[model samples]
Target: MHAQHDIVIVGGGLVGASLAIALENSGLDVAMVEAAPPGALPPVFDERNLSLAEASCHALQALKIWPLLQTASPIRRIHASRVGDFGRVSLDASEVGREAFGHVVIARDFGEALEKRLGDVASLTRYRPARFIDTQGLADGRREVRVADAEGEHRITTRLLVGADGMKSAVRSSLGIDATRHDYGQTLFVSRVRPQRPPDGTAWERLGPHGPTAFLPRFDRHYGVVHGVPSEEADAVAALDEAAWLARLQDAFGWRAGRFVASGERSRYPAVRVVAERLTAPRAVLLGNAAQSIHPIGAQGFNLGLRDALTLVEEITAHGLDDAAMLESYAARRSEDRARTLAFSDGMARASSNEGLAMRGLRSLGMAALANVPGLRAQVVAGGMGYRGDVPAMCRENAQ
Candidate 1:
């Protein structure tokens, strides 16, 4: 015999663990199974900072974590434009009637905070660094989670199973849902670099021959550099030392920011678009990257994953955790959003990164037009705000 829980959520990363917290005291016993060790949780924010949109701020606030995060710097303005052959167009925060579109938080701090919050949740139990040995459905609509941890093999049974494992979710494999994976053959190099001066309240990006290089302001005189380059060239650049790396950045990004200085070690990641064929099954649901993961071109991956977690929480709460309708509703709502964001993000990344002259001209023109069109701007803004239309009580309230 094994202890049973109402829901067994796999993966305790940002979205997954946050999902567990959101459901706290929701009259359900939630168990989170993570693949990372308990005491080995290292600082994760050293490498990258995440930009949280206005809607994301509001939603996270509802989870009782956003207020504490306000101490981190908020981006009051976003200076966006097309850097290719076409002329440039920009948008200011004031024009949209807001302080800033959102804010940024170091990745390590964000993860640590979420993990700490989970520990405080009275009803949530954590099984850190647990490996799944077997998971099969029972005849009574109950699912069993066979996990191996320090305690050895143990079973976790629940009426519903959640797969929030991430882009390479293992739960998805056990469920046998086909995944659609696309390799863009590009890599994102992320690190913190100092600019000529503290950025003047905005970020800069140069879309060029190799890839798009961006300078995101952190604070003081430092800016976070996110360079999207061909996978083939990523390693060679990442291996450079401080002075040499700074030179490479200058040549690739130009002197628009005055001067570039090395402040953080460079890290790289292969970019891809991963989608699960189905979001829901009989008594299971997938959230976050487990459902879908897309290129980071527009900073859409995390934003989209947050929506998936929030929406799933809403569906389960409204339709009963064990009801098939809950899973279906989550799938339907998310599929629409998942498809729209993925298409927009992947299509744009591909179009913007193309080396061909014809496509470049088209992308440049499209960028200029979108900037000039008021209606188009509003639509893009709303989408960026994570506007999903009639969101759940928790999400809707927080997105205020």
Candidate 2:
């Protein structure tokens, strides 16, 4: 006989874990299956930095997960420019009537914080170091999921099966959901650097011929670095020594922030945009990277995923988890938000990479216009701060 659960979350990373936490005390039997060890950091957060939008902060606060997090540096301003070009734009948080645009935190820190709260939720059952082997859809709106852990294999029948798994989601594969993938032909090198004139709660994005390089404020006067380069040149770029790498970065980004004085270990990932054609099918659903993996140029990856988790919780709580009509409503509500975010991120990546004179001039003009127009600037700030369209109820709760 298979154990039954109200919901079975197939991934235990940020998005999956957030869903489990959001469902706590809702009188539902929930289980999270994670392939990684309980306390070990997942590869997704190994060295990435997260620019948590204001909406994300609100959602985290509602879940009571924000208090456990530390090392978040507030962003008061944003500076955008194209290297060796005339286009420039600056966005101030004060203009938007907010304390700061957003907060930057190490991805690992977020995972650690989530780990601390996971055990506190008495109603959430977690199977660490477990893998989702397969799934079988039943006729009565439930799915039988096979999970393998150290002890042995376990079968779970769940009214709702959420695939929070990453790009290569086994759950999504089992359901045969097709994704439209677009490769940007670029790779991003990420690390930390100490700028001589350290960022004062400001995030900077410098677009160049290769791609965009972002400097997000970090704790202890350091800036989290995300430098994009051609995929063909990634190995060569990574081969450079610390000093040489810093020199290359300076050459690309100019002296906008300041001289780079120190450095840390670096990581790189390919730039790609992947959107699953369908988010929901029968009793299963996809969230986070599994639903849509967009380019990280705009820092919308995790913010978008968190919205997925929060909104799903809202729908499931409003109607019982087994309500097929409610599940359809959940999918409909998410369609607009997901489409807009994916397009924005995909468009940003393309605009930053195209170096044609016409494209460059257009980008410059758009940036300048956005900087000067109050309405346009406000929209950019709002979107950048993760206020893109209707989101979770918690995000709007006490929203500034």
Compare the candidates by lDDT and give the number of the best one: 2
Question: Per-residue CA lDDT of candidate 2, range 1-400, in tens?
Answer: 3788889999988899999999996899999988888668677767788989999988899888999887888989888888756868887888768888779999888888988888799988787888999897685667899988878888998998999998878898899899888988999999999999878898989987677899999987999999999999999999999999999889888888889988899999998887899998788899999999888877888999999988888898898876778778888888878888988888888887787899878888898898788888877777877788777888876786
User: Over 4 Å off in model 2, which ranges?
Assistant: none
Q: What lDDT score is found at residue 233 in candidate 2?
A: 99
Q: Positional deviation of 253 in candidate 1, in angstroms?
A: 2.1
- Writing each residue's lDDT as its tens digit, candidate 1 over 1-400 gives 3878888898877778778988886889998887888865523335676777677777788887875563356566555544556756465667888777666677776776776677779998888878766578764778888888887898888888889888888889888889999988888888888776777657566766445677776754678778877888777877777898888788877777788755677788788888899887777878888888888766777878888888877777789875667787777777767877888888877776677879877877877877788998887776766664544455566333
> Model 1: residues >4 Å from true position, as ranges?
42-46, 388-390, 398-400
lDDT of candidates 1 onward, in order: 0.75, 0.87
Please report, as a residue range, the 10-residue window in candidate 2 with the lowest summed lDDT. 38-47
Candidate 1 CA-lDDT value = 0.75
